[model samples]
Target: MYAVIKTGGKQYRVIAGQKLKIEQIAADIGQQITLNEVLAVGSGEGLVVGTPLVSGASVVAKVVSQGRHDKVRIFKMRRRKHYQKRQGHRQNYTEIQVETVNA
Candidate 1:
C-alpha cells in the first residue's frame, strides 16, 4: 500500500520502508513519528482520498537522520547602480523511514 502525506507545506507519496527527506521536524534521531496528515491511501485495487485528512488513518515513520541540504547560492546585481549582493543558504531537513500506513 501507499499513502499521500503532507508535511512542511509539501505533499509526498510514500510507501512502507521508503526513506524520504522532508522539511525539518523537531524530533530526535531514532524517534518514531506519526504523520497524521494523510491525504490519501491506495492499495492494489483502488484509492481513497480524504477531504482534508482521513480520520483514523496515519503513516508511522522513524527518524533516520537530521541534516542540512547542499547550499544554494543567490546573487543579485544592478547594472547602472553597481549594486551587488550574494547569499547562500542550506535548508534543514529530516530523513525518515516509513514503517507503516495504517488506514
Candidate 2:
C-alpha cells in the first residue's frame, strides 16, 4: 500500500521500503517517526482521501540521515545601473525510509 502524508509543510507519496528525502525535521538518525497527517491512502482497488487529514491513518518511517542539499546559486543584475548580486543557499533535508502505511 501507499500513502500521501504531510510534513514540513510539504506532501510526499511514499510506500513501504521506499527511501526519500524531505524537508528537514527535528529527528535524529535511526529514529522512528510516525507521520499522522496522512492525506490519502491507496491500494489496488480504490483510494481513501481525507477532507483535511485521514483519521487514524499514519505512515511510519525511519530516519536514515540528516543533511543539506546541493547549493543553489542566485544572481541578479542590472545592465544600465551596473548593479549585480549573487547568493548561494543549501537547504536542509532528512532522508527517511518508509516502513509501513497503516490505514
Q: Cα miss at 48, model 2 (Å)? A: 0.5
Off by over 4 Å in 2: none
Model 2: weakest 10-residue lDDT segment is 6-15
TM-score of candidate 2 on Cα atoms, chains taken together: 0.97
Give the per-residue lDDT digits (tens) of candidate 2, residues 1-103. 9999998899888999999999999998999999999999999888999998989999999999999999999999999998999999999999999999999
lDDT leader: 1
Reference-based TM-score, model 1: 0.97
Q: After superposition, how far is residue 18 of candidate 1 from its true place, in Å?
A: 0.4
Q: What's the C-alpha lDDT at position 26 in model 2?
A: 96
Count clashing pairs, candidate 1: 0
Clashing pairs in 2: none
User: How does residue 51 of candidate 1 score in lDDT?
Assistant: 95
- Predicted candidate 1 versus true structure: per-residue lDDT over 40-82, tens digit per residue: 9999888999998988899999999999999999999999998
Give the lDDT of residue 64 in candidate 2. Answer: 99
lDDT of 1: 0.97
